[model samples]
Target chain A: MHDQPSLAELLQAVKHFIDETASPNLSGHPAFHARVASNVLATALRDLEVRTANESAEAASLKTLLAVSDGRSLDDMNRELCKRIQSGDLTATSHGLIAHLKATTIAQVKTDQPRYSGLKTAES
Target chain B: MQDFEAAAHRLFSKVFGAEADLSDINRLSGGASQETWALSGGHFEAILRRAPGGVRPTRPSAAIGLATEAALIRIAGKESLPVAKILHVLTPKDELGEGFVMSRVHGETIARPILRDETFAAARLKLPGECGAALAGIHKIATNTLPDLPSSNGSDQIAQYEDIYRGFDIPHPVFELALTWLKANQPAPIDPVLVHGDFRLGNLIVDEQGLAAILDWELAHLGDPREDLAWICVNSWRFGVTENRVGGFGQLEPMLQAYADAGGAVFSTQEIDWWEMLGTLKWGVMCMIMYEAFRSGADPSVERAAIGRRVSETEIDLINLLEAANA
Candidate 1:
């Protein structure tokens, strides 16, 4: 509604410029840093694309694991989970805890590193 | 800005005791704490490890100081271990601040090439056993002959990580869980020995023949020998080829057998497994620290920011390790 080139599009355009135009002219550490900058932009774009759904999915899983439906933020819920685990109220063998941990972690990896080899193995 | 060339010339004159033609004084890549420069003077070529800005040497909590590091390298060399020979440690007269110069041993330090390049195919096959044998030599160094090093115990180590994690103020449930698991499973104390804390693929210089020189002793500490063995086998160090467990070079048997064969203490697979999990968590915490550095503007490297994302990789690995053990 606001503009034709959305946030993701703009980021991609900038990343393309860095990768194709800016990088070739540079050499040594500058070139290496330019490449890393491009990768960071790519990750930022990926995060923007996946952030909302990933947060919701994580929140849903946390609700099921913690058995709460209150409107706590995802960060708050994760902190609560950590507290429980650390205090020994919940453990690795706790009911549904490992499943929740594994599922949520896999979801994170998907958002952050879709090409990570462990993704396939962790899924099964 | 300090004149690097003039400083290098002064350093060369002092070490070689005469002026010689020095060239190709280029900085090698990798490592953030210490600056490494490769320079050749006349027939002499060496790598200089120096404190940046000519100030006092700074290192992680566990490191012995640079003077001690120089001494340790000398001792390791005497034992016939494949270590860079120490040529000179900085003296006040040198005016180059704190650090040491060592004779450069040529090989590959980059992990990807060592794992994938056709040039190192033969080296890959034999590296694990050689690493194990080398570790045996490290563990045998007598503490009495060494400078006073802070001996780290399991509880103190975990407590230190806990402190650092809290300081970061970022709640990582996975890391908290790992900390709990580590605390619950703290290994019974063993006789502490010299641990090459960062003994992984990057720290080892690999030639076509095999490991040419063991480098980067900054993280060297007095701890369990199993810490060294397990750290090298951490998943991240494998550089994507996870199948070859021993630093992505080969299986565990050859390494372990070579260790035992070389008169090193034989540890059970379970022992190594425990240490490996700990190693994964430690690496994750270290990554988080890098992020904190990035956040605080101390280090503005994109690499550090990217490495922050890698904490999740360790999370997945931690879950798998714990779940398998629990099962």
Candidate 2:
């Protein structure tokens, strides 16, 4: 429904401007900050690309992990799951907890730190 | 620059007996809690660590005041603990509020150059052992001579982390799991010793030789010495060289062996591993705190927000730690 230069395209363009235009001219602290700003934009772009799929995957995974029969919002389900873990209803030894946590964290790393070594190792 | 120089002259004249011809004044990168200024005056060169805007903010957990930090540095120097020598503690008369001046010992504090650069290839090999020995010296600071310190053991520290995590009110199941595990597997308490709470590469001044100075005593506390030993090995401090767990410079055995050789407490790798898990979770919680700060607009900066994303890295680390333990 939107224009041809999509959200991702616009984000990529802005990030390129920062990396190619602003960062090259700047130096010292300002240059460092500009790089970080570009990174922030890149991360946003990654999230835009993968967020829906990741969230749906996480929701489905959480439902199975917790054995939820009723529908719950993803945030509420996660909060409930955390509470369960905190209360010792679920534990480190709890079946499927490790796999669920790994999958969920890997999903996060994919968006937040795609090149993170841990993610690479996990995938391999 | 003129105003800063004038102030510096006045401060030096008041703190010491004579005027100081100050030069090479540079503002060094410092933490959110403090600012660092480097300057040299004729024969006297020093780094000034001070609170922002000349007013000392309320001290955070385990951080002794800058005045006490100056004394601690003096104590560490007395024990030959690779600390910069303290020259002057600020008084109200100095007009530069809430900081102390220390003789600047120059070297790199950033991790990447220390870890990778050919210039520091030799230092990398020696750093693990040097760090272990320096930590040994730190632990040797006499308890009687210590400034008023808040003593803490494992449970006490866990409670502090719990308070911090709860205050943030973010749902982190990994953090909860870590907290639960730490509680269940509480390491038997050893007699408390002086712990360098943030003894990692970023806080060290490394050169071609090795560690020249142990900087950033802000997080000093009284706790298990193993806490100090394990914190340096935390994955976050490893930069990218995760294989070399000791600040991404060398292996755990050499560091531990050096610690034992230097008359420090001998701890099992298992104990250190436990503390490493704790350290990882603690860092994750700290990152969450930074995120909260960013979200609340208390410290609106890209750096803080980016650090928040690093919590996921810690989560992956926690998962790895837990999975290994489970296996």
Candidate 3:
């Protein structure tokens, strides 16, 4: 593997610099952009921590929901799920549809924005 | 930049007087094509909103032109609705561009301070009702007397946003589900009125007393008035205070009551709920549009890039709304 600092650590360092140093020192649009940059880094770090497990879970859910045995990529499975929903084959009342959507969406929000109020509402 | 300042100076001199001295001219936050500027001259304080580069190119294809926006503001002001008074609509002779100067309304437009700060504790209680009444006033403006504007009902909007979403060609299962729900539950048509297409926290100016003014009429159009009511209640505009649904300040019932008190058409909770779900989906699609713009390098700012990730937040919200509806 690479040297001491992991990918998450490197991202955290950049985020720290932006939040603690760069953002505080700037003003106006630059300052706002600095904060956004820090947020981007934080999101990156979160995604790095959870991406593998989340993607596998999402893939398995999609496979079962779509009832496919072949090894389709996650993107292909997701596109198929969307097509089925769009075509009226899958619906809110359809078996396992809402469950799959909820699980997938919650997993995404966990990485995208764990603190979003919708997560709390969805979990409840 | 010097030329712009000189032109603005001349425009102010013509309007305020030959002796009018322009100072503190600062460009405020706005889109790339649109510009909002704050300026003052002695006792004269006003805001300048314009399409920079001296041409009106209707960028989004939804905006009623600057002149029409000014007219709407003037008409709204005449109806005693809280809005900035339009002072002057620019002429070709003014040479500054297509825009208008208006008496600045002093208030906070930022969401956090208005939602959470102790300074606005009193205003928060009154704001939801005030917003309801203001929206009632907007919807009541006789559409026949207004300038030609686009109009759309529920299905029309669904088609419009769906078309745009499809254009992106990215399959969002949640968005597809929302589309299905929206189509299956289209609200019955009503006589279309002047709908302030974007009536939310950021577009409202809240002062110590309450809502001082409604700004940003670029998205103004003719549609169902419930669209305005539900737009405010959308969770995205709640700014984290999701419990109080009406713009994160108060509950929905009081706001609906205030709207009725001010002569707006009474609406059922179920009716408004439909529109709220639609509003959430619309914002999600809008986030996708912003992400596309960023990805295409049209406006490659960190802000635009970050907004792309916010689509998941909308997904979670849609899931909650759907679950609640199903329950």
Tens digits of per-residue lDDT for model 1, B195-299: 878899888999999989998887778889998999887887887787788898888879989999998998877788888888888888898887777887877
- lDDT, candidate 1, at A81: 90
The residue-level lDDT of candidate 3 at B269 comes to 83
**Model 3 lDDT per residue over B27-97, tens place:** 77535447788888898878889985667753434788889999988999999999999989999887788
Q: Measured with DockQ on alpha carbons, how good is candidate 2? A: 0.63
lDDT of each residue in A71-113, candidate 3, tens digit only: 8999999899989998999999999999999998998888888
Which tens-of-lDDT digit does each residue in B231-292 have in candidate 2? 98888788878778888889999999999899998888989988988999888888887777
Query: Top lDDT: which candidate number?
Result: 3
Error of 1 at A116 (Å): 3.4
Single out the weakest 10-residue window by summed lDDT for candidate 3 chain B: B52-61
Score each candidate by Cα lDDT: 0.83, 0.83, 0.88
Question: What are the chain A TM-scores for all the models, listed individually?
Answer: 0.89, 0.93, 0.94
Give candidate 2 regions above 4 Å deviation: A1-5, B1-5, B12-19, B41-44, B58-60
> Which 10 successive residues of model 1 chain A have the least lDDT summed?
A112-121
Which candidate model has the greater lDDT, 2 or 3?
3
Interface RMSDs of the predictions, in order, are 1.7, 1.7, 1.5
* DockQ-based class of model 3: medium
